[model samples]
Structures are given as structure tokens and as C-alpha cells.
Target: MRVHLGSDHAGLDLKNHLVAWLSEHGYEPVDHGPFVYDALDDYPVFCLRAAEGVAKARAAGGDDLGVVIGGSGNGEQMAANKVEGIRCALVWSEDTAKLAREHNDAQMVSVGGRMHSLEDMTRFVELFLAEPFSGDERHVRRIGQLDHYDRTRELPPLPESAIGLGPDA
Candidate 1:
């Protein structure tokens, strides 16, 4: 599989390390930016582009994914998710990393470099790559609803039990 990667200055080293690591682990790595660190660099540009690369690859029938990194990863994930068709998840733990893919079908993973040690980062990425989406009906349905909402700007209908007045009213 091909993986696209991007990061701000804070995550540049990690992104570089992962590029080599990913290639050694038998995946093609696409470095999206920060060829040379720019202290004033913005995260969204690279993150969005990386996510776009993955989305475009999928549209072309390629099995590509993306990883975005930053000091906190929160902004990067949010920006990546703004791109249509990109499901970017902020991953802090191995379980959450794997679950992002398994439950949300996330095509992009955002990691906070300041929050974890190198070993844990490696473990989290490995777990994320190893897991497969369960594709359970409810998960699929909910993701579909999110997609519908994204397109239609409509709120999900409330559950039946939540739609009525209280009995004591």
C-alpha cells in the first residue's frame, strides 16, 4: 500500500523517520511536504494535501492512505477531515489507532508527536496498519449517515425514544 505523509515543523522528524520506516516495512511512502523545515510552516496545507492524495488515490482504485502529524495533532486531523471523502482520526493510543480504521474506516491518521514516546508512536502506527475494519452493519450505517449529513447539511434524525415529550408533561 502507498501511504502519504505530512507534518508541521514539530512533526517533521517523526514524519521523516516514518517515511524510512514505512519503506522498510514494505509500503510506499509519499512525502507531501516540509522537504526542509520551515519554522513558520502551517499544518493544514500539508495535512490537507496528504489527505487529498489518499482520497484521489482511492478514487483511482488505489489502496493508499495518509498520516498527518503535529504537536497536538488535533488541528491537523480537523483540517484533513475537512477535505471531502477523507476520514481522518486523531490517534493517541494503539487501540484508538486501530479502532479509527476498524470503526470509522479512517483513511488518514493524525498523531501527536509531543504526547508519546518514539516506541509508542511506532506501536500505534503498526497497530493501525494491521487492523481491518470489521464492517459491521451499524458501523457502516452510521458512517453512511455521516456521509449523508456531510453532503446534505442535515442533522441525523433523533432516535425514536428521544423524539417525544416526557410522560409527566
Candidate 2:
């Protein structure tokens, strides 16, 4: 699979390490990077580009994924989510990483470089890459709703049961 990666100064080291690790593990790692560390560098530029790469690849029918990293990964995740058709999940643990893929069908993941050990963060990435979306009916329905909302700027009507009122009432 093609994995796109981007990070600011805070995550540069981990990003570099992951690039090497991913190659050794038989995954193609594309670095959308700062290249040289600059403390004043912005995360959005690289993160958004990486997210866009994933979106374009998937649109082209290629199997691809993305990873964005920062000090807390909050901004990176936020930036990635702004791109249309991108579902970027901020992953903190193994479970969250797996669930991001299984439940959310996330095309991208964000990780905090300062929050955990290198091994733990890498493990989370591995779990995320390995897990497949559950593809349950409910999950598919929810994803469709989200896609519909994204395409149409209109809210989906709430079900009658959810509104806590009968059809006549």
C-alpha cells in the first residue's frame, strides 16, 4: 500500500523513522515533508498535501492511506479533515487506531509524536494499516449519510423515533 506521511518539526524524527520502517515492512512510504526542520514550519501545508494525495490515489482506484503527525496531532488531524472526502482520525492507542479503520473507514490517521514511545506509536500505525473496515450494514449506512452530508449542505432528517414523537404528533 502507498502510505503518505507529513509532519512538522515536532514529528520530524518519528516521521523519518516511520519512512524507513514502512519501507522495510514492504509498504511504499511517500514523504510530504518539511525536508529540513524549521521550528516555524506549518503543519497544514504538508498534512493537507498528504491528505490530498490519499484522496487522489483512492479516487484513482489505488489502495492508499495517510499519516499526519505533530506535537499533539490535533492540528494535523483538523487540517486533514478539512479536505473533501478525507476521513482523518486522530489515533492515540492501538484500539483507537484499529477502530478508526474498522468503524470509521478512515483514509488517514494522525498521531502525536510527543505523547508516546516510538514503539507504541509505530504499533498503532501498524494496527491501523492492518485492520480492514468492518463493512457492516449500519457502518455503511452511517458512512453514506456522512458522504451525503458532505456533498449536500443539508442535514439529514431525523428518524421519527429519534425525534421522540409519533408521525401524527
TM-scores for all predictions: 0.95, 0.95
Model 1: per-residue lDDT, tens digit, 70-152? 99899999989999989989999988999998999898899998989877887788788878889999999999999999999
Evaluated at residue 142, the lDDT of candidate 2 is 92
Expressed as tens digits, the lDDT of each residue in 1-169 for candidate 2 is: 9999999999999999999999999999999997889999999989999999999999999989999999999999999999899999999999999999999999999999999899999999999999999999999999889999999977777886778566534
**List of clashing residue pairs for candidate 1:** none
Backbone clashes per model, in order?
0, 0
Candidate 2 clashes between residue pairs 3 or more apart in a chain or in different chains: none
Off by over 4 Å in 2: 164-169
Candidate 2 lDDT at 141 equals 91
